[model samples]
Target: MKSFVFRQFEIRQSADVFRVGTDGVLLGSLADIRNARKVLEVGTGTGLISLMLAQRNPKAEFLGLDINQEAVELTRLNFESSPFHSRLKNIHQDFKTFDTQDKFDAIVTNPPYFEASGSEKDKIARQTVELNFRELISKSSELLSEQGVFSLIIPAESGNDFMKMAQENHLFLIRQIHIKGIEGSKNKRLILEFSLTEKALEESEFIIEKSPRQYSDPYLELTKEFHVFKNRS
Candidate 1:
């Protein structure tokens, strides 16, 4: 597995553990963490999202939870090796069974959106075999503070269903970012944020590429602080 090297930290990957990808990076970079002091990451794959959040908000402390033991260990290693080591922590625990009286200022996750697929490694990280959308919404509603926000990156097709479930849990949609793989392409992903308080929804679109293999200006600018792209514009 190829490690994702950032300006301030590195994500060392293992073959069995889920690798750092664009989705995690997008959530880390785009998730609103400015007002959050205590953040909880539901699925800590390689610790990428929390690490990026920690870098973005120096005052924020992060706690990561993962059902997979190997992922938890890998996330711990990545967190310990980063500059924000003191502010980051990870545990091997399933979010479904996680019982915490402490409320998080921000609950973030790149949830398992894929349906159940028979596989041994990394299946739990990608599929909803253990945790589904309804479960995630219910637990997040219970764990988020009054002004706390629940944020996630998921497939475009799943957006409506997720929002519906969240609304049922009294989580209002606050922000939504539609992601297009190409400039003129249909949305491929959505970066969503929900809060307890009802507020005006903020909607926006982000394009990942201008053309094949070319990063869009907005995408490049959004990730400038973290990405160490060669010949970066």
Candidate 2:
């Protein structure tokens, strides 16, 4: 087991499951969760996002859903050992077939982005083998409450198509943040927030590093609470 220690909780990632990464941490730290009582994390690998959000929104209850049994069990353990264990739950079920009468105030995901090209496990983790963007958007729209918000981080190139799909499902873009590897790098990822109602989009850009291995000030500020060495000089 590989363990990652954050300021509030520790996450242990099993060798066979999806490991915690910057994308997950970014979505977890940046997603808006204010006044959200019921939150759901789709494809919650190792439960990292849920734990982070739980720390931010102390009153929210989190449900982590994953299709892989091993991933679900690993997430369960991670949640159980966290300080917010009482407010977190994990279920092993494919998002496409997951049936829930209860709706969510907020839903977040760091979904698969690439086409199939790697090993079986890697293909499932990276490719849309289990869940594609269209299905994810449609299903999430149905699961969201009237005032619900859906937050996600995806490849920057797929933004236009994703926004089209979201609009088809009656989900409108409310906020967008483009992520770059460094100050001069091209945008690589997009952090987006959508809602049921159409609103003027709030857009911004974030750079992870000012140079190789040098964390940008904005990145450090956003993740300062969770990263122990964010202030390294």
Candidate 3:
């Protein structure tokens, strides 16, 4: 297990299914949140995305949901200890089963995508987090307010499939940022922002590092607000 302490939040994670990784960070930073007034984080592992959303939109309120009891407790503790505690709340329940009368201006998730072939841990994690593309899109569409955005990160291979599902559910791709570990490498992550309104926007790519030891300028600039040494060479 390893932990990362950022200026505003902390992640205690394992190589296990629930670990918080760079993909989540990329999605949280890439999400266009300046206009969001209310946010929902569907699978807030350690409350990282919720905290990031709160950091960027100080006036916004965040609701973080997770099915795992440990994760829920940890997120609650993390939120209370954080400087933005007043703006964040955590719910310990499966998103599918949780009932909320409110609609959010933004919904963000770092969805679990690996189809479980075997292993108990993998199976449980997938069941709790990963969802079929159709179900995810339809359910998210049901939850999102009209003209609201659904932002998420998932495996790059699933991008087009998820986008098709999103389209069928009346969600339009507003912005997309593909991410790779370094130059000329295969893209591993897709950060997506979808809206009900059809609006023209730019599409781009983000390389996290130029090489193993060198962080990309775009990555640093996007995350500099919360990650210390983000701009340091």
How high is the CA lDDT of each candidate model?
Answer: 0.93, 0.92, 0.79
Candidate 3 segments whose C-alpha is farther than 4 A from its true place? 1-3, 12-17, 121-130, 230-233
Better TM-score candidate (2, 3): 2
Question: By descending TM-score, how would the candidates be arranged?
Answer: 1, 2, 3
Error of 2 at 199 (Å): 1.8
What lDDT score is found at residue 20 in candidate 3?
61
**CA lDDT of 157 in candidate 3?**
91
User: 118, model 1: CA deviation in Å?
Assistant: 3.0
- Per lDDT, the best of the predicted structures is 1
User: In candidate 2, what are the lDDT values of residues 91-205, reduced to their tens digit?
Assistant: 9889999898999999999999887665676556678989999999999999999888999999999999999999888999999999998999999999999999788999999
- Model 1 residue 187 distance off true place after TM-score fit, in angstroms: 0.6
> Over the stretch 123-187, how does candidate 1's per-residue lDDT look in tens digits?
88888998999999999999999999899999999999999999999999999999999989999
TM-score pick, better of 1 and 3: 1
Greater-lDDT candidate between 1 and 2: 1
Identify the runs in model 1 with alpha carbons over 4 angstroms from their true place: 119-121
Model 3 misses residue 91 by how many Å? 0.6
Write down the TM-score for model 2: 0.97
**Residue pairs in candidate 2 whose N, alpha carbon or C atoms collide under 3 angstroms:** none
Local distance difference test, candidate 3: 0.79
